[model samples]
Each structure stands twice: as C-alpha cells, then as structure tokens.
Target: MRPKIYLFGDSITEESFGDGGWGSSLAHHFARTVDVVLRGYSGYNTRWAVKVAERVFGAAEGGGGGVNNEEPLVVTVFFGANDACLPNRCSAFQHVPLDEYKRNLRSIVSFLKKRWPTTRILLITPPPIDEDGRLRHPYIENPSNEPERTNEAAGAYAKACVKLAGECGIPVIDLWTKMQQFPDWKNACLRDGLHLTRSGNEIVFEEVVKKLAEEGFSPETLPVDLPLITEIDPRDPLKSFQQ
Candidate 1:
C-alpha cells in the first residue's frame, strides 16, 4: 500500500480539497507515491479535536477499534483559527483558553507519538486574520458586529504552536508569521478573514512539501506503488508484476 499523510484541523483543512487547494496540490505532487488523508472538522478547536482523535486515527479494517497497521508517513496538526476567537464575541462559543489550547496541542502530539512513534508529525499555526475582511464577511449575526478574531490573538496561538513544536523536536509551519512577510498578505492569502485563498494554500503546499522532503518522503525518495504504463512491455505485461 502507498504511504499516507493525514491532515487534521478545522475549516481551513476541511476545504483543502477544493480547487487550487494545498491538499489537492500535495496529492498531485505525490501521485502514486503517497495518499493524503483529510480529517478536518469545520470550526473545531484543539479542545474538541483531542476528544475525537483516537477514533479518527484508528483503523476501521479489522474492527471498530482496530488500528491501521501501517504508520502514516506524516500527520499534520493544523488548528487554532477558531481557538483564537475572542471569548466575549459572537464566536465565543468556539474560544478555547490559551493555556488549555497549548495543553491540548501537547496532548495531541503525545497521542500521535505514543501511537506511531516513527511517524513524522508537523504542526501548522493559524494564519493571520484580516479584521476588516472578517467584518465584511461575518460568519454569524453579531449584536455588536465586532470582528471575533484578530491577527494579534492568532499570533499568540501561533507562537504557542511554534514553541510546542520546538519542544517536541518536530517541524512546524508558522503560517501566521510567514503570511505577513508578504506584501498585501491580507488580500493575497485570506479569502474572508481566516479561511485560505489559493495563494494561501500555495504557501502551505510549498512548505509542507519542503517538510516532507526533509523527512525523506519526496517523490524521488519514496517508492511508487505501481510501475508506470511505459514500464510494461506489451508482449509480456506480466514482467512488470514480477518486479
């Protein structure tokens, strides 16, 4: 079977298979070499994610609680957009306290490591927020109409994520800091305020590919599951299977 890569996070990851999305880009880039699995929960926070992780990661093949025998090549922990929402705002229902958010991330990393010690795990921080853009595209009705999420708040979460990765000795994609480095990033990277645009997805795809390469999962490094059509001889197609 081909190796797998699991994506775990919220709405941004849930929509990552849409046109020009990073997940799709990675699937295309890897082709026959690996499988990219999406396990996204729209509007989910780290607090909620930890509760359902085992069920999500456990394999359904042998039985309800059976574990997938083959370890995934990598698993991405991408979250915090919703967790960073202001506690007193319209989206307050989704807000997770900062300290708790950090603990949840640590718990998640611990779970993945205990379950699959050899698997490479990476963390992706929440992206920068565009306050005015969020106001323009409000997700829910608000009595005060204030933007529920701010870039400053997201940055705090992002920094925590980065620090966690450093402590764990794992790779991390600091989307919050990286996106801002680009000029007009608010317009270029985000669609509404938190969700990603095509360009934003590109940054993710490129960064992930770099991480995968560093961990020895690139196209040239990983073995393709099947031989190319050209590799099969018309007269003796069976020869391809022998290899």
Candidate 2:
C-alpha cells in the first residue's frame, strides 16, 4: 500500500487542496511516493477536531488505522484562526477560550499519538490577519466595525501552539511570526485577511517540506511506490513485467 500524509485542520486546511494550495503542492512533490489525504473542515477549531479525530485516525476492527498498518507518514495539525476569534466581537459559535484551545490541542496530539505512535505530528500556528482587509471583506457580523479576529489575538494562539509543540516534543510552524517578517504581509500573503493567498501557501509548503526532510520523509529517502522504468529489463520485458 502507498504511504499517506494527512493534513488536518480548519478552513485554511480545507482549502489547501485547491488551486495553488499548500496541500496540492505537497501532493505533487510526493507523487509516486505517497498519497496526501486532506481532512480539513472549514471553520473547525481544535475543539471540533478532537471530536472527529478517532473516526479519522483510529484503527479499524479488521484493518490497520493508517496506511499499510503503519501510521501515516505525517499529520499536520493546523488551526487557531477561528479559535482566536474575539469572543465579545465575534459569534460565540467559533470562539474558543484560549485555555480551552490549548487543552483541545494537547488532547488532539495525545489522542493521535496513542492511536498511531509512529506518525509524525506537526502543528501549524494560524497566520496573521489584516484588520483593514477584514473590514473590507466583512465576512463576520460586527456592529462595532471591529474585526472578529485580530493579529494580536491570533499571535497569542500562535505562541500557545509553539509552546504546546515544544512540550509535546513535536515540530511546529509558527506562521503568525514568520508571515509578518515579509513586507506588506497583509497583501502579500493573505487574500481576505484570513485565508491564504498564493504566497502564503508557498511559504507553508516550503516549511512543511523542510520539516519532512528533517524527519527523513523526503522523497530522496522514501521508496518510490512504483517500479522505475530502468528496473525493467529491455531484453526480457515479459520477465521484467512478471518480476
């Protein structure tokens, strides 16, 4: 069976397989070596993710949980954008208390580790939001004309994610911090002050690849899923085919 890489999280992840998305870039990179499985639920926070974690990663009665009785090669936990929603400013439906957010993230990592001990987990902090961009888009209702989420609030969650990953001994991509390093990040990386633009996706894809390489999941190290053309014998094609 082919190896698998799982991407799990909220809308950012949900849209990760779309055109010019990070997930798609990874899929292309790992072609013939593994499959990239996307389990993104739009608007979901860690709280919601924990509820469905088992269904997605748990072992089946007669079958192995992940690919080929081995845990998925990698599982990315990306969230916090929605959870960082300013409670008083945004709808309560999406706002998760900071403490609760941390708890939920820990629970998610622990649960996955318990079920798939060999799987590598990478946590991704939410990217920064542009208040001006948000105001222009107005995706959320705000009578006070305030953005539902702010860079400052999301930065807190990002810090929490980094801390959690350190405690758990896992890798983390602190997008919130990294994205802003670029000039004009608001327009360069984000589309609507929330979702990622092509540049944002590029950064995410690069970071993920770097982490995978560090963890020995690089295509150079992994066995290709199919036989190479060079492996087939030119003099005895039938025998090579059978072999």
Candidate 3:
C-alpha cells in the first residue's frame, strides 16, 4: 500500500470542471503508481474545510477520528478562492482582508498539524485572474467589479499565505508564478480567468510532481494504484497535450 494523501479545499481543488482541477490532475499524476485521496468541495472556502476536517479527523477511531491506524496520511490545504470572490461575498475586499485571510489560513494549518502531528502539510497559493477577480458577484456599484479579473489584492493574500507557511514550517507551491510564465496561459488554465481549465490543471500537476521530487520523496515508495494520467487535450497545438 502507498501513503495516503488527503486534499481538502473548494472547487479548484475538487476539479469541478471535469478533469480541469489540480486535485484531479494530481490524482492522475500519482494514482497510477501511488495512493491519493481527492476530497475537494465546490463553492467552499477555508472556513468550510474546517467542518470537513472536524468530521474526518476530529477524534480517533474510537471517537470519530481521521486516523485509520493503518495508513500514513498527508494533508494538503488549498483555499482562498471563494474567499477572494469579493463584492457579493463582501463589500469589495471586505470579507477576507489580508489579515483575516491569513489568520484563517493559519488557524486551519495549526489545527491540522495539532491533529496530525506526523502528517505533511502543503500550503498552495491561489491562482491568478484575468481582470475583475476580486469582485465576487451581485455587482451593484463597485468600481472594482468591472471586467478586470486580475485582482491585485490577491497578491497580498498569496504573500501572506507564503509567510504563514514559512512561520508554520510547511512547504508551499507557488502556482501564481508558474501560471504567469505560460503563453496565453490564462486561456488554457482558467475558464473565467478565475477558475482553472484543463491545461491549467496540467500546470498544477507538473508543479506538484516537481515539488515532491525536490523534497526528496521517492516515487517508488508511492502506491501502485495512484492516478497517472498520460495525456491531455491533443487538439491544442501545445506540447502540453501528451499521448
């Protein structure tokens, strides 16, 4: 059996766009040769994930715990998408201020670490946007709720996450920078400049694999049932699509 890694997060983590989510891509990348658990919820923020964790990892087997006493579990927390939705969720960046967002993120990590002291924790920064990324919806008269999906405010949130992870002694995958490097990357990666697309999911998978390798995690030790996807969309001319 391979080590069990649990992913907890919102739509981007859940791969709601078919196989366009990072979690799905990650599962495909490792599932063919390792063990992976894809547990992602749509339209949920970091706050919601707490509820899921409480149910699965609150106590031990004798008391509704997340541990099975038979497998090594690794938990990865990816959030802050919906929280950053803005406008509708809040009054344009009022809901999850950088400080509050950081606080919540830190709280989640601290809780999980305390619960599973031996588990590996990975903190992923939310992806970028096209124009109006901050404004969530229900737009009324917010100047920031136009077509500009690229939320400059998101950078603050991402930086806070990195800083927090560093303080907590955990690893972070900088998806923000990776996405920027791709050509016309926004189109292939995200459906609405906010959500991820099939190609975007591939980028995440690639990054996760690289991170695991950089951390000295040997692929051989992973389970055989891990999802290993071979190809993506071939119709697109990009080499990203495999066989």
Candidate 4:
C-alpha cells in the first residue's frame, strides 16, 4: 500500500488544496510515492479538534474503514488563527484561552502519536494577521470595522505552539515569524489578514519540503509507484505488463 501524509488543522488547512495551495504542492511533489490526506476542518480550533481526534485518526479494528493497517509517514498540525480571536471581538465564538489552547494542542499531538506511533509529526504556528486588511474584508460585521484578530494575539499562540512542539520533541514551522520577514508581507503573504495567499502557500510548501529533508524523507529516498518504462519488455508488451 502507498504510504500517506496527513494534514490536520482548521480553515487554513481546508483551503490548502485550493489553487496554488501548499497541500497541493506537496501532493504534486510526492505524486505516486505517497497519498496526501487532508483532514482540515474549517473554523475549528484545537479545543474542537481534540474532541474528534480519535474518530479521525484512531486505529481501526475488524477491517473497518479506519487506517488500522496503514499509518501515515508524516502528519502536520496547523491551527490557532480562530483560537487567537479576541474574547470580545466579532469572532468570539472561536476564542480559546491561551492555557486551554496549549492543553488542546498537546492533546492533539498525543493522540496522533498514539494512533500513528511511527509517524513524524510537524506543528505549524498560525500565520500573523494583518489588521487593516482584515477590517477591509467585505464580510466583516463589526460596526467599527475592527479586525477580529491581531498579529500580536496570533503571535502569542504561535509562541505557545513552538514551545509545545519543543516539549513534544517535534519540529515546528514558525510561519508567523518567518512570513513577517518577507518584504511587504502584509499584502504578499496574507489575503484577508488570516488566510494565506499564493505566495504565502509557496512559502509554506518550501518550508515543509525543507523539514521533510531534515527528517530524512527527501524525494531521493522515497519509492516511485511504478517501474521505469525502460524496464518493460518491448518484444512482449502483454508479458511485460503481467510481470
């Protein structure tokens, strides 16, 4: 069976399959070598993610459709944008206390470790927000057009995420910090303050590939799904196929 790479998180993740998305880039990079499974739940925070962790990743028993027989080679956890929403903001429903957020993140990592014991886990910090851009979003409901999230708030969660990754002995992609270093990052990296743009996704994909190389999963080490065409017999095509 083909190995798998699992991506778990919230809206940022759910949209990772979109045009010029990071998930799509990874899928293309590993095409035929591994299956990329996206388990993104838009608008979900770590608190909600923890509740359904087992259901999504638990090992199967008795031939159920669960992944009992196969474990993902890599799993990435990316969340926190919604959780960083200000308690009194328009997006209060998604607010999660800093302490609770840390606990939930730990729980998520623990669950993945238990279910896929040999899988390498990567934790990604939520990207920084652009308050002015967010306020300009047509869908925002605040009368004062106040942004629901702030880069400072998201940075705090990002810090917590990095700390948790260290405690768990996993690698983390500090997107919040790294993206801001780019020139004109506010407009180049994020589209609506919270979600990533094409350039941002490219950065994410690049970082992920770098991490995979560091973890020894470089393309040179992975197996291709099919044999080379040169290996097929020209004299007997049917026989070569059967072989």
Off by more than 4 A, model 3: 56-58, 65-73, 87-94, 132-150, 223-243
User: Quick one: best lDDT, which candidate?
Assistant: 1
Q: How many Å off is the CA of 209 in candidate 2?
A: 0.2
TM-score of each: 0.95, 0.93, 0.75, 0.94
Residue pair clashes in candidate 1: none
Model 3 lDDT-worst window of ten:
132-141
For candidate 2, the per-residue lDDT at 139 reads: 67
Candidate rank order under TM-score: 1, 4, 2, 3
Winner on lDDT (2 vs 3) = 2
- Candidate 2 lDDT over residue span 87-153, tens digit each: 8885558999999999999999998787679999999999998988888887666788878889999
- Global lDDT of each candidate: 0.91, 0.89, 0.66, 0.89
Task: Please give the range of 10 consecutive residues that has the lowest summed lDDT in model 1.
Answer: 59-68
Q: Encode model 4's per-residue lDDT on 127-156: one tens digit a residue.
A: 999999888883557865678899999999
The true-versus-predicted C-alpha distance at residue 157 of model 1, in Å, is 0.3
**Residue 31 error, candidate 2, Å:** 0.7
Q: Which of 1 and 4 is ahead in TM-score?
A: 1
Candidate 2's C-alpha runs over 4 A off are: 58-70
TM-score of 4: 0.94
lDDT of 1 by residue, 1-243 (tens): 888999999999999999999999999999989999888899999999998887778733433452475788899999999999999999999999999999999999999898889999999999999999999999799788899999999999999999999999999999999999999999999999888999999999999999878888899998878888989999999999998
Q: Give the lDDT of residue 138 in candidate 4.
A: 32
